[model samples]
Target: MDSMASAPGKAILFGEHAVVYDKPAIALAINKRATITIKESHKDYTSIKSDNIGLEAIISPETGLKLKKGEIGILNYILKALEFYHDSKPIKIKLEIEIPIGAGLGSSAAVTVATIAALDKYHKRKTTLPSIAKRAHKVELEVQGAASPLDTSISTHGGLIYLNEEKKIDQIKGDLKDSLVIGYTQSEDTAKMVKLVKERMERHPTIINHIMDAIAHTTKKAKKALETNDKECLGELMNINQGLLDAIGVNTRSLSDMIYTSREAGALGSKITGAGGGGSIIAYSPNRTRKIIETLKRKGYNAMKADPSKKGVIIEH
Candidate 1:
């Protein structure tokens, strides 16, 4: 039997670095997804392959081998999923991901969750969303040394999610699709970026604390904007949130370029989407997505018109 599963990528609409400080953060699942296929194999060892990351390796389920160096090191998360479920049967696994790696697009979370979902189904173990998310969070923690449940939760449940300091998660109801444009600055050092923010906080705790409180406040208003379907208000909050992120020193030159360029091109609001020293930026362009995409691309930046994903993980035989 073959088992296939897929999970969507995610973006932080409001609150990035502040979320680490236990501040409220809002995230949306994007249309892009990472998919995995698992099939029992007759061979003695299991093998995994992915052209997207140019990884091909065969390892004994009993004793895994060392993986190649670099960001593809994230495959450790997938391997951890297999071990978690104790499915030792030799199998062939294939992964295909639409999310960009290290761009703060939840590529790691998507792939890890999809891997666990596929393995669980392959072994005839019907797992719950909370269970899958918990296991995926472990994988991230082991790999990143730190992780927020927001990415794993959003990848597992999809749609719009609001997460607060107490770890309460709510699925906000609204149709936010087609109202945002996402731009990538080709950042490959999320760990380094996160470290920069931590250093700033170490140097100025009081200032960082105030910024975190402001971001939390903006997140509450963001929830109101979503419930009331107020795109303009949401845009304004994104602008405010971005300013706070800039004050905390997470904004990079490339990120600022994308944010300002999109705003100048008629985006209602724009800001860095994730661990912002360098990564991706999001712009609220309800009516001018095409114009925003064209402008960003013409300026030689990687850009795409993005919409929110309604479903989390989908399974197929």
Candidate 2:
């Protein structure tokens, strides 16, 4: 028997770096997702394969996890997730990922969440959503060194998620109504960007602390806007959040151009969606979504529409 699961990726709307400091952040699960399929292995040791990263390897208690040269570390999320299950039976794991890697779209979280869900179902553990979320967060913390619960929580619960300073996860009552447009450049190192912000915060604690406070306030306002379906207010708040992200030195030339160009093309508000060194930017354009996408394409950007996903991790059998 094969147990398969899929989890949606996420886009941070109002907060990113500030959330690491226990500030509030808002995120929504996107349609893009990562799917994992698990089956009992005939071989003695467990094996993992992912065409997305073009790698395959064996994982076992005796040998431990090993990565070949030139392979990325995103697989660490999978390895860490496997550690929690404690299943003696070896399994063959396969990954099918739609979300772009290292683009700050919560790819790691999606993969981790899906992997855990699949394993739980395969082992007949029947883990609850909160339990799955907690385990996934642990995997992220182990792999990333520093990670907020926002991504893992959103990936586990789906819909619009509000993560508070207390690390509480809430599903906001509202919908994006297909107003979101994503423009992505090259992949960015989320950990590196996060460390950069940390360094800046250490050098100027007072100033950076104020900026975090402002981002938290903006995230709160954006939450209300989402509940009330106030697209205009949400857009404005997003712009404010973008400026704060820039102040933290996460902005890049290409990301800035994409944002400004989207705004000029009639985006109500446009800003970086994640750690923001070279990942992706989101534009809230509502009826003008197509126009913004076309305009962004003309400027040599990869742009697309991503609707908010209401479903989280699920067993597919």
Top-scoring candidate (TM-score): 2
Model 2: worst 10 consecutive residues (lDDT sum): 64-73
Candidate 2 residue spans exceeding 4 A from truth: 60-70
Q: How accurate is candidate 1 locally (lDDT)?
A: 0.86
Query: How far in Å is the alpha carbon of 161 misplaced in model 1?
Result: 1.0
Off by over 4 Å in 1: 61-63, 66-71
Q: TM-scores of the models, in the given order? A: 0.94, 0.95
Tens digits of per-residue lDDT for model 1 on 1-317?
89999999999998787777788899999999999999888998887888887777777746766444234455777778877775577898998988888788898899999999998898888799998888998888777776778899999999999998987889998667777899997674556666777887899988888888999999999999989989889889989999998898777888999999999999989998988767799999887899999999998889987789989988786
Count residue pairs with overlapping backbones in model 1: 0
Writing each residue's lDDT as its tens digit, candidate 2 over 1-317 gives: 68999999999988899999999999999999999999888987888888876868786668866554326566778888888764667889899898988888999999999999998888788689999999999998888888998899999999988888899888888768668899998666788888889999999999999999999999999999989999889889999999999899999999999999999999889999988889899999888889988999999999989899999998885
> Candidate 2: global Cα-lDDT?
0.88
> What's the C-alpha lDDT at position 238 in model 2?
90
Shift in Å, residue 306, candidate 2: 1.0
